[model samples]
Target: MDVDDYIGGGSGGGGEALIGMKTVEAPDDGSNCLICLDGGGGGGEKTTTEAWVETPCAHRFHSRCLESWAQVKLGTCPMCRRELTAAAAAATTTAGEDVHVLVADPMVADPLLARWNLFVQRSTDGSRSMSSLVRVLAVSHVLPDEVAAGGAWPPPPPHVVELSFLDNLQVSKAAIQRLFFYDGGSLPPFESVVRSLQSSLAAVLAVFLPLAGKLAYLPEPGDVVIDYSPDAVSPGVKFVEAEYSGSVDDMRRLASDDEHHTEAFLQLVPELEVSMLPAPLLAVQVTRPRDDHAGGGGGAVAVGVAIHHGVADGQSVWQFIKAWAAAARGGSPAGQGLVKLSRVAADVIKGQRTRTFLLRADQIRSLKRRISRRIAAGEPPRETASPVTAYVAIASLVWTSVVRAKPHDAADEAYLMVTADCRRRLRPPIDPGYFGNCVAACYARANVGTLRRGGGDNGGDDEGLARAAAAIGAAIREQLEDPLGGDIEGWLQFHLSLPAARLTAVGSSHRFMAYETDLGWGAPSRVELVSPFARELVMLLGAAGGGVQVSVSLDEAHMDAFETSWFQTAAGDVTV
Candidate 1:
């Protein structure tokens, strides 16, 4: 991780320093530094105390043992492969004491204030240092009252909502970090762009917050607390401008690689530098303005929201955005689309009480064992294969095929899964601020045969595939609209109250996409969810330069065919 990445988010609370821990240092030598330190050594010296040192490699070894060490180390420094380290290892054992606190600017204080309490209650899905390569753009705008009074700047208004993962699946750190790319084009003008975004978002917020009501569930200390002048100890917002001008594929490639993406991305932001964020709950990016004269397609911006999983669900994030937009536009957004959170909760509670269909412990255990055995024996288990459970099944088919199955299955099939947010499906409905994950997984089995043929006009052996994809989309829409198995709240509560062993036994295959990041510029060029979070089929839905952007992952062999089929379907002229 680049240490520089954390500078802006705030770090280094004055405290006791840890001894014997030196900050890992990188060599400043002008040479293109070797990534590894272990391999740099000479053969001439005799004593163990006498060691060979390399510049950027930053490794030292006894001269006599250099060759063997280098051979064994395989070009990496034995201690750490990262090029640089801090001056000293931070030695604080206390969690919050050493944690960096960001000072809120009074200008943005109101916005931060309006949201911080709810922010504290939401879980951030436990993302690591590397979150998204995109950044949130906060615009400075004059409040209506302030403008009326001839004020120069307006106080900020903050808002926060909990994101619930319907089925209680864990969203990994790596998955969240993969949303942005390192090689995308340059950063846009901050103030100028933010002004537009804030304008839009504020209009939305005005409509949303009041309709949603206040967060009824604020934790004791809450997850996020905003202080306009949060003590001098708080770290202020840091800025890093990023800009990149390259072919689409190059940017796409950079976005694909997690390790180098963020840092490499920072290099491109020449104007407003990228700064470290204190566990960002959101990331926004606005691309350079598109030239209307250039042609039909317009340029785009990306917004990514990285909320603590403990907080809200995608639907909640969407709701918040709608509200912000309404508020900014001087009119409330149509609240017709919102799913009442409280009603969802009430419905779930009543359903559970009425159904009396709780699984018996023995039944649960038996089911677990059966699935476990099938998993171990390398067999497809159909017992749990409902449409709601299809994601896991399809994922199993795809993953298993990828790792151990035959050429036909592995070659043809690819993992396919859908992300389901559960705000509307709850029984009585849940509250908007309910801090927990309320998401579900829906999986589809895909292969060249499943998704590439026979759709609309071009029937070049791909109609069947196109038809299948359309059916899959329809199925997803149906499942979500139907509450029976789609009631994510009930499923989540059950899981939450279940035994740990049983919970693990179920082994969910859902993945969360960090798609809500919106900070002004616009939205990302493209967002792809990747590894340690793999499935036979992966589906990502996000707001993009274009309308809602959807990307599905398939095996490399079928990718070309799938892309063709998808585009054909998208064209609207296709029947599939």
Candidate 2:
């Protein structure tokens, strides 16, 4: 449905006016404190000494407790290290009138979430968050030449991202109504909202919901009620109710349409007024695929989101999902989001909980080791000097494997794409602590069969793909473990300082392989990891319990064999 239709087509100006006022100080004695309530403290003395200080992200912690836990290493919040102090964050706030946004969920208008819905009754406290599911960004690389030369792989500049939530049909209509309508208005602080979005990007997966029998927990994308407001103060917060059409196909087409969907998405960006890249967390989309026709090759609904990596990673996003799910299902201890992940300088001796300099020192040591080993072995010159990422390497390997798997199909070429995590790459980053999808696509590809499978001209065993994947993974791990001198700013400066000719030759798009198909119903019908945008080759791979999920585009005849062979390789029986 178009934005207007999804928002019920009317001006939606008459609903109860919900204003964004300064957050009230939470109740002490662990009543309003998520951590203290969740028992995050080490217990005994730790519990007594710690009092939760509400953060801009809506998360509560003991004053100076988390901040002083780790001295160095990822000194920033484990949630992505964004500063939280009011002074350091003042510039990001936009002051103005409010826009009439939509409150998608009218069924539960209480606004306040119940505290009981926060914890996972079946799992540990640390495991309840959604930040664990996925991490890894898919960035769309603008090839240097494409930007400099123009028109080769021409497409309109990418438009705004459209995020939608998928609701669960099995949920009883009465239950949905209770969760949406009867809940009280205990919405988290704006700071918690931002941090939650970052958590989603970190691959945390959890869902939140509100209901009558149960207290109002945080809400996830799938809950019956969804709300939207302008990120900045220029527009007043508006809530719209979305009519569930009950079809994901409809949602996908509407979301991807450049004209209608893109326009609505763009309208929301400026309101966010993010100082760095417009790393707004767009919107949360909830999708559920059922097993109506199990064993049949039927498609499943998967929620697609575009988050700037400057926010969070896959792990954090997964955490958010779990939380949301617990809330939606009426789990206990609801509404409490995950604690902030950062080093605390005050918690440890010398004002350090973790070794701040360990990672850097390790990196230096590794580099020295590499140099010595290279000199001793007299290795050949390397092809690329920059670091590599796991997604890049895996993508390369998958691309090469695809070409090798099908030798006869030389006429049609394959494209390579990589999903880039823009959380850190973007300018003024999103709330570093939020948990949600914050990734973009990046890729590289070549005509595998034609170029190397001995079809017409080039003829060689494709060795580079495997090597590339390994190399990319190593490079990315290195960076994550040790990091570079400066952040994205330094990287941008270095790039801009390079020679113009060099800049002009930069390549953006590459082949990519993604494993996103989650079949709660059963195995995926068919999973092809194709990029929404254009690129050389795209491979989609999902995972089931016993075997890995895979999708590829090749000669129709060869697809069957590839599938059979893959299962054989993946399902190798144990041997003594």
Candidate 3:
């Protein structure tokens, strides 16, 4: 920011520059001034107000330090960082309003004019082939001065909301990818970082104010409501800003195992077409892969979010993406210091394949001390006093290696199901930042001859891993006790008495650290489960070298017997 202090409010003898901004000399550098020490040096001859203002990554700058830093404050390039001119980042914006700057700039003659109705551009490069051109540039709506008064709006109340039993089942979308590395860092212009991410996402929808609301079905209390008005978040949060040419190691090969690389990150989040329902509970996409798309600027920037698993889970979407990345890295909109989980639902099968495995941390402390010494040596009226975590020893070794990778009927029954966290065991306690979906499910059956590995011929694989960690730690302590009586009518009668064949389900809960939801683009190198229809869903996550990543979901004929009965000589790190 130091181009000779850009002082021009009333320019004295040594300052005269901003008075009619003129300084042109852009045509492939020869280095006369590029902004300072001398385009007017002992080489003489330089007038028309010191000329030298070229950008759009052409470098040169001096018409008063590129019109005082790219026309008033950081459109960037104090010394060639490049980026400036989408009509100078849409001519001026400090607080007045509009700041849409979309630039694919093919020598600009229309990259997206006509108020940016759509401005798609994509290229993940394999010689320009990943091509993604999603464009819907602006559709504002961030409300929260508690809007509600166009004459006391329809006697309010009953915008109708309430759907517990873990937000009315049949699981909903919840993908939460977040990569943000600027490898050595320097990304100031993309319309000033999406206008400070649309004003810190309207200051975090005024503290998660019903996530800018929406999610309906109120037809005569047949239930399913979450309206919030302000025209149900006026379709806001669809704030997208994408551009990719490729390179952040080609956008980390789109977290591969290709399901069209997680359907190209579900088209970078924002597809709530639950096939319709006043849907779109929340959505956001901000990406920048770039290595070539005219003026390279790569290294990483991905912030995908898709919500509506009945409105939050995955610890309320990593506490609303770590409070919207601490309000987009400046701060405000916090308080929910993490910890929430359990919301399981399955049945969306179609080919199904989703792999990713790793369990470092001393193999999760040697599978929590061999399932806490087989649940403290079991016997009468429940044996095993304590210690057996890593989520009940990795959901009892992924439900006994997915029932030893398919082989049923020791007279049937396999079931695993699990998931727990009914907010401090229900009966009205909810505020661990009560975002939504309180979660609860338990069922823990087993009997394909005690889960198949060596078909229990008088147990001895440490008594079939402490009898599958005492049936998933007594079905997560009977669905977190405390009068959970009919824990939501026995988890909706154990998913309507599971007849979903061999049954399997364990859910996301690596102690909800979920790759530490660090929005500062430096933690998540991976954490994906793009739910392409949870075929026997598994997903765990916490590993990045520390321990635990599970993820599963088979059906390529039981992914080689569940990767040789859960990763033991099945050719490493596995990805499709």
* Candidate 2 backbone clash number: 172
Best by TM-score: 1
Count of residue pairs whose backbone atoms collide, per candidate: 132, 172, 11
C-alpha positional error of residue 216 in candidate 2 after TM-score superposition, expressed in Å? 26
**Poorest stretch of ten by lDDT in candidate 2:** 174-183
lDDT of 3 by residue, 1-576 (tens): 222222233321122222222234433222344432234322134422444554434445444434433322224454444334333332332333221221121111111111111211121212124344333344444444234223333324444456655564422333233333233244454556567767776667666656667666553433455676666755555666666545656666665433335445544554443434555567666666555233224355555666666667666777777777687777776655222222221222456666667767766676666555545656212444335676776777777777777756676777788678777777666566666666666777766675554322123344455567677777778667853566443343345445444677877678656666554434555666564434467877675556777777777677678767655422133333
TM-score of every candidate relative to the true structure? 0.37, 0.30, 0.30
lDDT of 2: 0.27
When 1 and 3 are scored with TM-score, the better candidate is 1
Residue range 61-142, candidate 1, lDDT tens digits: 3222222222222222333532111233232222222222122221121221122222221212122123433322233222
RMSD of each: 18.2, 24.7, 23.3
Candidate 3: worst 10 consecutive residues by lDDT? 108-117
Tens digits of per-residue lDDT, candidate 2, 1-576, equal 121211211111133221111223334332222311222321121223443443334444343323321111111222233433323224333345221222223233211111111211111123325422211122121111222233332222221112211011111101100000010123233233223333332222211111000111122321221111112211211111122222334433433331222221211111111112111232332222222112123322333332222222443434443443333333422244423222100111111110000012222233233333332332212333233332343344344434455543455434433444444744455455534334432223344443232111023222343333433444344444422224543433333222211011111212211222221222223222111111112322222222222223333444444434332222222110
1 against 2, candidate with superior TM-score: 1
